[model samples]
Target: MTATAVAASVPVARGYRFELVKLWSQRRVRLLLLTCWAGPALFVAAVSQQSTLPVDTLFGRWMHATGWAGPLVTLGFAGTWALPLLTSVVAGDVFAAEDRLGTWRHLLLAVRSPRRIFAAKVLASLTVIMLLVAGLAAGSTAGGLLTVGNHPLVGLDGHPLAPADAAGTVLLAWICVLAPTLALAAIGLLGSVALGRSPMGLLLPVLVALGLQLAQMMPLPVPVRVALPGYAFIAWNGLFTSPAQLGPLLIGITVSLVWAVTAAGLAYRIFLRRDFTDQAYDGAGRRALTSGLLPLAGVLVVTIAVIVPVTGGPSSGIEQDKVQRSVATAFAHLYRLQTEQLHRPAVTEVQLDTSAACTRGGGRLEPQGPGNDWRCVVSWHLPGVPAAGSATYQLDLTPDGRFMADGDGPKEVNGYFLVRTPAGDAPNPLWQFDGTVALLPTVPKG
Candidate 1:
């Protein structure tokens, strides 16, 4: 059979199958697959044995006890570099492996078309990445249930999630990450096609992922940050929380698709126009890179320019009335919890007044921005204590909508005071009341 006839006989799907089979035959690929399915058990064991949690990562604080937190913790670590590395392993080498082995020239002449080859390579890389993620998710979920137990999971709102619900939520979060993972894979493919070297292709995409993660950490404009892939990576954290905000998740999906598709398109254009005859290491490499990367760079600049000004910042200033209501409601709920700790009378919503004049730095507090200098004059009645007269509270608003307030309360000798002391003892109680209160955003009543 002629080479042309053989190539012509193979459909796009067959080409993809062949590429996948070639990858699967590699010893290194098999080892990577094994690691993907096995690493999570080790992670579970290590985390279980630790006395302290890795609070630096999202969901890390809850990992010690909740069976569901295992996947969340894994995602946090994966967001840093693991996902990028896993997806890049196949993508970085798929195209360059052809060049490195001096097979591109033969394939270029014999293959049905460059477009078919490009599509086949992309499908193969995506299949490997999907498998890697699936293995990790399955391993992590199994290890967590085995070691941590399927207890009810605590959410961001301090509410409890049923074990069944928690399990489903974790699965959804993993699905959410797939978009960005594919984007990372696309990035590696771009590097592979552009540089035509396996090692550089593998390393550059991971470096770019790292750069995007850094950009997320810095105080870039919200639009710019959200436009980046890292934003989607971290946004998955919200799914574990009560009253889960789906807006970020939707935005992340859209942005990730845009980035992956655009990047893959750029890479495809380069591959489609590539000349197999002029296979010089330097000149061809430079041309491939310049042609592939320049358009994407232009797209990024134009995107930033258009989005930054449109999403500069909140223009309609903060309304103190809304702030007062929100703060007071949050305080009432948190105070009820604190009362429970002290074994006191339950505080109800009807017992509290949500009206107050709030101020920041001696000015009418606008609902916008974060500051350490907000004050609210609030009044509430306890069971025995009379109208604990309108007291002045110093409120510190965080950018994430949480507030901590220290209010002027009953006068004390020093620090906190105990309610009941042991008879015949030095009147020292096991618990005491402090004047500080921490408030979270008001969870909507069902």
Candidate 2:
């Protein structure tokens, strides 16, 4: 490279090293890293000793059944608040702390350019965030294997995943989550630069995350919810299903990138224009607000434009046929587990020839959308039994295509919440099952 280029790159490299050293010296950053490495394992150990399981979270009920469930369950819980908090604590405070310490002026007067300093801080913060995520993933995997044992994991689609497949899926799920976590870190950086206060910078990104989560739970349009930042966190659910739904995953990555770039770019603009010499200077006036809002508005418009083409078509809603197929397949797999627990001959899902008829709100509404009032009657055949058996299930579904189905079959078979096994009374897989439905259209099976 030319001499000028080499000279220019030196400042960024030096600034990056300096920023890393600054982060390493902080007590809170060191403590947070340690916690990330140990917290999930500790949680798994505690859960293993308890009789009650966290059945609400995905893979929660299977914590004791498979070592793989520990990381997955922890991932589900982390998406709500832990991830946002983890990213914000560092990125939010990194820039603003310099202001509080009155070190910004000295840093600006140094040989490093403001742009190079900004780049260095961003790189350092992202590196730290990646480490924290890796720590959590490794810790949870180790904890689960040690405490729960490496048993086969039951997939969301009711199929049993071998140990190797389960491990790969768990790893992939964590990797998928990294995109949104980085996006949240970018938001924290934006808050830190704009607010110029350590406390607000740390808290603002977390509050924004909380708000997005609340909006997700509300009854909003499918396209709108998909466009939100929080959707990326839960989109990893698709990974645990058979065939692995990639549509939501793709959309999530796109949405997160848009937010991250927009936030970081605005922060860069503000940092470049601010008069650092003035101690009383603040970046919170009408002009600043307008500048920020205009870019955000444009971002939203672009996001919608991209999302509508992918998710706006008429075939985007829930399909009854798909739901019935998913319910039937899940029931068949769980029924085989139930039979095995009873010491009966195990039946394969195909041999059972399972089929289901589902309806919403007592048949008053179309069973094509998200609602809690859905019901299905699943019927299947068993070898040596002339008469076919049937069971009724109540399904509570969410906008994001996840559902919990409660079966009303005979207690001696699949109705009881718990089934007795040689190990002890474990959760009856057939009693209540969780599964996901693809929102996008798929080719019909013959």
Q: How many clashing pairs per prediction, in order?
A: 4, 0
Clashing pairs in 1: 318-366, 318-367, 318-368, 319-367
The estimated TM-scores of all candidates read 0.74, 0.92
lDDT of 1 by residue, 26-48 (tens): 89889988987899867875786
Candidate 2 lDDT, 275-333, residue by residue in tens: 67767655445554565657766776677667776775634357799899889878888
* TM-score, prediction 2: 0.92
Instruction: Summing lDDT over every window of 10 consecutive residues in candidate 2, give the lowest-scoring window.
Output: 1-10
